[model samples]
Target: MCGRFALFTPVSELTNKVGAVMPEREIHPRYNVAPGTWVASIRQASEDSAPTLEEMWWGFRPSWAKGKGTQPINARVETVATNNYFKSAFAKHRCLVLADGWYEWIKNSSPKQPHYLCRRDREPLYFAAVYAERDDGGLGCAILTEQARGSAADVHDRMPLILDDDSLEHWLAPDLTHKETIHSMVRHIDAGLVEHWSVSTAVNKPSEGQGDELINPL
Candidate 1:
């Protein structure tokens, strides 16, 4: 699961690649992103509108399910299409969680060995996600996860659904609501293109969350 990750890349640099109207709020860089905190997400106001960058709560709890008292940070891809809590968002509110990389732990380690995963070239990453409006009016989001692949499988059995650059437009197309079309047209970044390294356990502590050292290989 993508419980903790980082996204210090400037929004100014992402405009070209993400094809979104940048947010007006000054976004500070974050080295250790945790659930419950707001993070940058690329989405559309409507099917006819251009994509835009906005701050979104990291936990997802649809307004209709507010009484359930749950805010999940990740949703399993396998059940996302049929699960009542996620099917609507999966079909209509699809979105992208912007990040530089993510973290995973080896459960058997004395103190789990945390590893940072990112592109070999260190470019920005777009994670498949879905969002909903909370009763309080906040936009909450949940990252999509599937069986781990490539080196990510070595650290954990599940990993965030990383999207291929070419599929960004298709994934955001509002008219394409059927899961069948999404599955056939959208694609995940090749697992082989992603890489990881052992990092300071500082990432394990959200309080020591800022600065580049947290991602520096130990």
Candidate 2:
């Protein structure tokens, strides 16, 4: 699951790569972005609307479920499209979490080791996601995850559903609500292109906050 990530790519580079308008506020490079914080994302309000960069809470819960349980940060791709809790947002509120890379801990490892995962080319990536309005009126989102593949499998049983560029616009199309249509139109980033390496465990603590040192190879 994508519990933590980093988005240090400059706002100008993100706008150029994502083809979304830059937010009025500048985005600071954050190396250890934890849950419960507002994060930059790419979203389309409607078919006719241009995609825009906006901040959204990293945790998600249906309005009715708010304050009822823990906010979920990851939504399994398999059930997200049909789960009553997620179907509505999955249908119309699909979005992309802008990230440079993410950190994952090796399951059950002694002394627990964490690793940094990113594109082999070190280019930015977008995580498939859906958002809903919170009781307080802010948009909160959950990253979609699928069974792990490639090197990510060694770290955990699941990994964020990283979308390929061709699927970005289609993934945001509110009109395409059919699950099959979505499956056929979107594709995950090729597994071979994603790689990971052992990193400092400082990421286990969110208070370590933003620092390139968090991602440095151990």
What's the true lDDT of residue 102 in model 2? Answer: 92
Q: In every candidate, how many clashes are there?
A: 0, 0
Clashing pairs in 2: none
Candidate-wise lDDT, in order: 0.89, 0.89
- In candidate 2 the C-alpha lDDT for residue 217 amounts to 92
Q: How accurate is candidate 1 locally (lDDT)?
A: 0.89
**lDDT measured at residue 167 in model 1 versus the true structure, 0 to 100:** 90
Ten contiguous residues with the weakest lDDT in model 1: 10-19
- Provide the RMSD of all predictions against the true structure, rounded to 1 decimal: 1.1, 1.3
Off by over 4 Å in 2: none
Identify the runs in model 1 with alpha carbons over 4 angstroms from their true place: none
Write candidate 2's Cα lDDT for 1-218 as tens digits: 88899899886786675578887788899999899999998888887888898999999976788668568999999999998889999988999998999999988876788999999999898999999988888899999999999988988889999998888889988799888999999999999998999998778888976889988898
lDDT of 1 at 183: 90
Q: What's the TM-score of each model vs. the native?
A: 0.96, 0.96
